[model samples]
Each structure stands twice: as structure tokens, then as C-alpha cells.
Target: MTTCRLCGSSNLASVVDLGATPPCERFLTSEQLDEEEPSFPLHLRVCTSCWLAQIPPLITPEETFTEYAYFSSYSRSWVDHAKSFVDAAVDRLALGRDSFVVEVASNDGYLLKHVVQQGIRCLGIEPSRNVGEAARAEGVPTSTTFLSESSGSEVRDGHGPADLVVANNVYAHIPDIVGFTKGLRALVADDGWVSIEVQHLLTLINNVQYDTIYHEHFQYYTVESARNALDSGGLSLVDVELLDTHGGSIRLWARPREVTGEQSARMVDVLEKEKAAGLHELSGYADFSANVTRVRLDLLRFLVAMEEAGKSVVGYGAPGKGNTLLNHCGIRTDLLPYTVDRNPYKHGRFTPGTRIPVLPPERIAADRPDYVLVLPWNLKAEIMTQLSYVAEWGGKLVFPIPRLEIVEVNS
Candidate 1:
């Protein structure tokens, strides 16, 4: 972390230090709980030279994604979002049955399945074998490997240039920003489009979404920084769209540098918004660290008060972000005994440093806890609807980030 990953600059300023925590997704089995766990410095810094906010690459992608625990299809809303993106991309790119589409980090074929249904040629480059197998089971032609400059070229050679390359929610996972970007360039055709969806730094700061900061996400991006990163790999940013996913995100439309045209109006508007927010400079990040502290304090206070009031509290989701929040706030099983998730992969495992048991979603109804702390608050609407039956026992839902609020559920 001595030099910026994007730009080789010694000048890096602290954005926030989440303290030392294990890789967010490293859920432990009962046997591993007795063993000592390893943690790393989870500090985030911003490069003054290029304005890219990043964390040290303490853990490699191989360590995290090889046996991934997260499956995108588990979240109904996310699957729907992926389907919408596929429909929109096909129409926008004028794709047809003859067109070829490729998606990077295509977990469980949640997206490419839509492309397959339309009789288009599609492939998924997923690193995780288990999830990749799941994708194959669903009829997605998947290549199990990490995406890099060389790998990207190989894919292009084997499958021919993709008409469209889709990377969703994975732009930040790679430590080698330049190489991954080049890999993206290699997978796409000279005239084909590359669409990437990543969490927007502007919204992250504005909304106090600090939990999204974890080891897997090597860097965070503003549209300005993203444009620079894209140019490094010979890809040109053509347009941008604001998305409400992952707290807040931006969908970047890019193309090979040779065929790139005038930047779209939406791209210009977003850059203007970034400049107005002072994101192009260091001022925009000045208040973020302090805001993060306030969130920690507020959440801790609520959990402690709930304990004192004899109200039983449990977690709703055991997502990676939830682990970050749980560890940063020093929450343990004493406060949150267990959390539930829809994914069966995590049913019997425990959350990485917190050691809270992960149970099935039905456990919530069986126990009828007084309060359910909803993690993965980005899916607030979907989760609220799923847990509407909580009202049967006058149970309430609690959200930790941005602020602590308790909402009574009504069936």
C-alpha cells in the first residue's frame, strides 16, 4: 500500500481504517471455529495523484473466489436486475441470435441464462469452480478461470470477439486494475460494447455506506477515476447510468479506443455531479471517516439498548457487507446469536470473525425473534416483503447503516 495501485504515487491519504478483520467471505465451519483466524489491515486510502480510493491487497482473488460462498441467484431482486440488464443490453446493442455475449464473474449464470434463452451465443468466465459448475448446470457455457490480459486474449481467440462484454459488480475485486481493464478490452470486439457495473464512490460517501469496504474490493471509483482506469487499458468511456443497486452504483458503457465516439450526455452529467461534490479533489472524502465513526457508535448503542431491554435481536442476512459491519462494531454472538440466509451453502457455517451461526431463513419464523437486524440493506424492499410475516408476533426490522432505525412490519 506504499504506492497507489492505479498510479505509482507515494502520496496516499487515509479515508477510513476499518481496523483488522478477516476476508469478509471467509465463513468458518464449526471445526474451524476452534482454530485461530487470520486478520489483515482493512485500511482504505485515496491517491491524491489519481483520486482512486483503495485498500491494501492483503488477500488475492484466488483465495476468495476459488470456493465462493455467494451465489447471485439467491437474491430474487438481483436476479431480476440481471434479467432487466440483459434485455436492455440486447436491445441497446442490437444483439440477435447470431450475436455473442460474454460475462465476467458470471456467478451461477444469473444473467447469461437470459442471453441463452434468446438463442444467442453466450459464455461466462467464472473463477469459482462450485459456482461455475452451478452455471454449467443451468446450461451456461462457462470458462473457469480468472480474467487477466492474457486470459482475455485467449477467450477472444477461442470464442471470437464478443459482441458485448458484461461485468457486473466485479470491477473493484481485482487488485491489478490496469491488467483487468486490459483483459476487459481484449474480450470485447473493436466495435463491441463493454458494460461494467460498480459501486459509485460518490454515493458511498454521500450515504455513509462504509460496510461495502472490504478486502475483496481493492479500489473504489468515481466516474473521473474510472475513466482514467478505462483509458489505461485502451477502453474509452462512452456513457454512464446511475443505478440503485449495492446501495448505489454506476453502469459504465465503454468501447475500444479506436471506435469510441462522443461521450454521452449522461456521462457528462455524472462527471459534473462528481466535480460539484468535489470528488475530483480530496475535499469530498474529508467527512467520510467521521461519518463512519458515527454509524459505528449509533449501531453499537442500539444493539446494547436492545440487549438491556430484553428484546431478542437476530440478523436477517449473512452477507459479506454484514460481516464487515459485525466485526467493525465488535458485535459477537452475545448480542446477535445467529443470522439467517437463503443460500444453503452458508446454512451451517459461521460468519468469519464474529462466529455467529448462520441458519436458514425459516429459522426467523420458527424463533420469532423480537427484532431482525436486516443486513444487505440494499435489498431493503425485497427483504421487507419477505419478512412481512414478522408482524405475526409484533416483530420489527432494524437497519444499521446510514443510521439505525427500527420499523414495525405489517403483514
Candidate 2:
């Protein structure tokens, strides 16, 4: 029986089943193109007792994220978001040259660039070799390995404890979440803070973002669920902020018990709202499966209809979220011939499982397909603005989540 990763509860219900899919970021090279991509069941379940949304245990960290193809610097909007985060963190913590900042899963030194500019001693822990190497090339001191109890102990011995420990959009990627949190306690100073930014589960469920359900994201965390995970490792959440990034996210500030601070009023308000909204109830998750099925059917119908009309359809953003949607909906090259991505590493490769070739964004401008399906719906606005030329050809952009709808360029 599969048990809850946090509370060890075996009581769970299958909320949405995404079938089998390959890891979204694992684009295949030309040499590896002949090999069949590995796929595993993409099932999401909610613990009836703990309200924790999680995927089944299948892939390990070593199998999923070592030679990662994604880089944070590729997205202009994501870079802007990271810069804003660094600015706020510096201001809130009153950090200076004496302060030390440690970032977990710090891909490509995007955020650390801002921290280092302030002359603060900053170190990054990135597990992916490709991304870590890129960060090193940019003068960001990065360690390429997973952060667990042993690694955290070594870090404490060498650099003492950190003044600020930041993790951006990475808390959900861990499998042994309990061990990860315990490691955070080891690396944090008594009066220091550990800030974590995660995609909020409530927002995802409300927005019908079934595409985010992938194996890479092992857990979907709510504030209540997060508090339990933190308390399990002797950490306490002191503040929380609702962020606009990642569609909707939460930035949580935590500290050891020795440091006392009032819980943010906004945090309390959101927690109470969640409690009232039945987040702690099992029935709240029951309807998600139906929504997932509806999304798949609608997207497939739209694609088949476009094909019948002789309108070529292409995809934008070869992100993990997009991969989940594609593979779950059984989308192959028959429906989407190719996808455009700005990430150089992913260029000239095929998306895992579906095998859709990924080319540079210039393909969108050159081919000007009749329909451009914005896969990463979270960045629909950013992508729409970038590919506005599609409108000149009487083409419309299709957003395939929540619902499949094509909107005019100015609409």
C-alpha cells in the first residue's frame, strides 16, 4: 500500500489519473532518438486524512534531475520574477556584506545574481549538472548534489549556518520531504530565516491546472500541509506572502523556535479561508478527476477539428507542464507537428514520450501555423505578446486549459 509521504497515512483517494508520461524536461538527443522513451503512471492522489496531494512513488531524484535541460535565465519573465524576489528578500532581511545567503535548487544563478551584487556571500545548491555548470560559469558558487541530512551537515561544518536560505519553486520536487526539511534546520542559523516559494495547491485546484500534475512534482502543498511537514522537522513558519508568480504561489518564511515573530495576518487569513473552503475534506478532491477528463476530451476535439480544417497547429513552451498535458491527452506529432522553445539545450530535440520535435521560436515566425497552442498557459500573456505576428496571418492562439478557447489577437 502506498502511504502518505508526510503523515504516513495509507488512507488516500485517486483524484486524477494522468496515465503514463515521460519526464517533461528529459528531451531526447538525436542519438537517443531511436530509443523508446521511458514512461510511468502519472497518478495524483489526495490523502484523505492529511489533505496532501501527491503522485505515486515511481521515479527517483537521481533518475529525474541530474542532467537537467532547463535553465532559469532563458525566460525573461522568470528572470524578472527572480530579480524581484531577490530585491524583496534583501530589503526584508536587511541583508548586507556580512550576511550569507544559500539558495536550494538555484538554477543558472538567476536569483543569486541579485544577491551577489549586494556583496553578500551566496552559495547555490543545484542538483542538475547542466544547470549547476551554467551557474558556475556565471560566477555563482554552486554545489551539484541533492540537499539531504548528510549534505546539510557538511555544509554546516564548512560554512557554518546561513543567514538566509531560499528555495524557489523547488519544495515540491523532493521525494523525502521530511528529510529535506530536517536538512533545512541543519543549515539555518538560530535567528536566521528559510524562505520557500511553492505553487499553491488551492490555486491550482481552483484554476483547473491539471497540466501541472507530473512525476517531477511529487507533492502538491497547501499551507496546512506545509506546516505539518515543517513542524515534523522542528521548524516553524513565521510569515507567508501570496505571490503573483507561477499563476499563484506562496512565499513562506520560517525560523527556528528560538526566534519569535507574530504570524503574518495574511497567512492566518488564508489559512482560515482554506479551512472554511473544505481543504481539509476529502470530497473537495473528488471532482478533480471529472475536470481532468473534460479537459482531455475538449483539447482533443479542438485539435482534431483544426486538423480537419487543414489548419496547422503548433505548440509554444516545451515546459514540464506542457509535457504533462500533451502525454496525458495522448497528443502525438499527428496533432502537434512541432513545438517552439527558447531554451537552447532543448532545441533540435524531441519531447519525451510524444516525440514532438522542438525547434527555436523562430519556427513560429517562419511557419506561422494557423493555430499556436499555448501549452504553458501561465505565460499565455507573455507568449501572446511575443508571437503577435500570428495575428497578421488571421491566426488565433489556443489556450488549452480550464477550457480550450481561441481568442483574437486584440481580444
Candidate 3:
């Protein structure tokens, strides 16, 4: 029986059963590709008690993250997004050399590096040893340890309380949700603020973004559930902004519940929208499974048609979401010859379950595929621009999620 992680309630409503899927980032070597791969049920559950939507962390964090495959700095668009966030955050907070910034799960210091460039004091708490070490080498003060109430207090004792804490796309991956968020509470100063960005659950359902559901992600949060999770850690919402990244995301600004602050209009506005969409009830999940099934069938038809048309198809990025899509749709190198990625770590490896060979981005031109299926559709604009030369040979770009469609862009 599945139970809600936060409230300890047994009333879990099944949202979508995604069969069994391997952990998304487990890119294999050629030799290991022949080895048997283990997979777990990709079932998602929503708590009728607290209305928190989550999937169990079927694999251990040590198994999933120690020597990680994903490095955040590889995506130029994502890096620029981080830099822009830094500029706005520094100015909005009136931060300077006097303020301290702590970023949890600061992958390769992608965001904190910008914080350091501005001469602000910054610390990165990264669990992935390789990624954390890389962050330190890049001159972002990084600690290679998981954040918890005890460890967070130790960090505060050594470096003093943080003035601003940033956590983007990290909370969902956590298994011990309450403990970790409580740690975030302990890490910040009384007057300090915490900013968290997570993909909105409402958007996931509407867009049929089941591909975003993988073993690494333990929970898919809505505004209501997110607020409750933060409140459990003694935090209260101060502001929120809806972002278009990762399909769709919500940026929440929170402060300690003890520190009085008025809720921003945007935060309240989003909360109402979430409520109107029935996010607080189990009915919000009714159509989710049906939508996901329709998407799977639609994607298969598109790929099959393109192959029969004598067109060569290759994938653009080997993101975790890409693995989910490929594995669920059961596409292999037969349907898609190969895929390319900018990160050198993934260059010689094969994607997890599908075992598609991954190559360097430069290989695309030589292979000269007719249709470049962008696996990481969230960053399609940046990728399409970088590979605009594909249009020179009459190649087209295709997006696999939201719908299977060919997107027209500048060559």
C-alpha cells in the first residue's frame, strides 16, 4: 500500500501507471549495454489527504546520483537562464559583498558562479561528488554532502546563516521531503528568503508531460501542495512566478512563518488558479492517465510515418526526459539511428533502457539526418538555432511532447 510521504495517509489515488522504467540518467557503456537492466514501476500517486502528488523513490540516492551523468552548464540556454536569474536576484534583494547566498543542488555551480562573479559570498551544497568537485574547481565554494537539518545547521555554524537560499529543480528529486525542506528552513537566517522553482503539476496534466515522470523525480508538486510542504518546514509564501522552462514551472518566494510578510498578488493569483483547476481534490487526476495513453499512441504513429517516408531520424539531446519518452514509446536505434549531446560525459555512452548510441554534436552534420527529433523539447529553440545548418540540407525539426509536430524555425 502506498502512503503519502508528508501526512502518512494511506489514501493515495493512482494517477498514471507508466509501466516499468529504468532510472533515466543511467547511460550505459557498450559492454554494459549487453548486461541485464533492472527497472521499477513508474506509477504516480496523489494524496487525497494532503493532495500531494508523488511517486515513490524506487532507487536509492546513492545508486542514482553519486557519480552523475547530468551537468547543468552544458546547456548554453540553461546557463544563460541562470545568469539572468543571478542579475535579477542580486538587484532585487539588494545583495552585495555583505550577503551570503546558499544554493542547494548547485550543479557545477551553473548559477552560483554568476553569484561569485558579482563578488557576493556564495556556498553550494551539492551531493553529487563529481559535480560538486567541479563546482569547487570553478571557484564556487561547494560542500559535497546532502542537506538535512543536522548538516544544514553544521553549515550555518561554519559559514553563518544564509541571507538568501536558492533551490531550483531539486526538491522533486528528494526522498525525505519533509526532512530536506526542514533543513532549508534551518539553513536560512530569520530575515532571509528562500526561492524554489518546480515544474507545476497543473501544466504537466494539461500538456500530457508524462515523460517528465521518472525514477529520479519522487514528487510532482502543485502550488497548494508546495505551500503545505514549505509550511511544514516553517515557511510561508511571499511571492510566486510562473515560468515557461521545463515545459512549465513555478518559482516560489518564501520566508520563515515567524517573519511577517504580505503575499504578493502573483502568488495569490496562482493559488486561486490552482484551486479553480481542482488541484485540491482527487478529480484533478481523472483525465491524466487517458491523456498520457493518447500521447504514446500519437508519438508512435509520427515516428513510424517519418521512417516509412525514407527520412533519416536522429535525436538532439539525451536528457532524462528523453530517456523516459524513448523507453515508454519503445524506440531504439532502429527507429532513431543515433542521438547527440553537448556534454562530453554522455558522448561515448548509450541511453539507459533504449541503448541508443550517443555521439558528439558535431557528428550530426556528417550523419546528415533528414529529421532531427529534439528529445529535450524544452530547449528546442536554442538547439534548433545551434543546428540551423540542418535546414541547408532540407532537414526539419520535430517536437515529441505536447503533440508530435514539425516545428518551423530559422535556418
Off by over 4 Å in 1: none
How many steric overlaps does candidate 1 have? 0
Best by lDDT: 1
TM-score-based ranking: 1, 3, 2
Model 2 agreement with the true structure over 223-291: per-residue lDDT tens digits:
888888888777898788887677788898899867858888988988987777677787567677888
Worst 10 residues of 1 by lDDT: 401-410
Model 2 stretches astray by more than 4 angstroms: none
lDDT of 3 by residue, 1-411 (tens): 368998899999899988898899999998897799999889999998888888887787778878899999998988998998889889898999999999999989999999999999999999899999899999999998888999999999999999999999998989888898889998999999899999999899888889999999999898888888998888888898999889899998999899949889888899898888888887778998898888889878878987899778898999999999999899998799899999999988999889999999999899888888999988867887888998778888888788887866567
Backbone clash pairs for candidate 1 read: none
When 2 and 3 are scored with lDDT, the better candidate is: 3
- Per-model lDDT: 0.94, 0.86, 0.89
Lowest lDDT sum, 10 consecutive residues, model 2, at: 277-286
Candidate number that wins on TM-score, 2 or 3: 3
lDDT tens readout by residue for model 1, 229-347 = 99999999999999999999999999999998999999999999999998888898899999999999998898899899999999999999999999999999999999999999999
Tell me how far the alpha carbon of residue 121 in candidate 3 is from the true structure, in angstroms, after superposition: 0.8
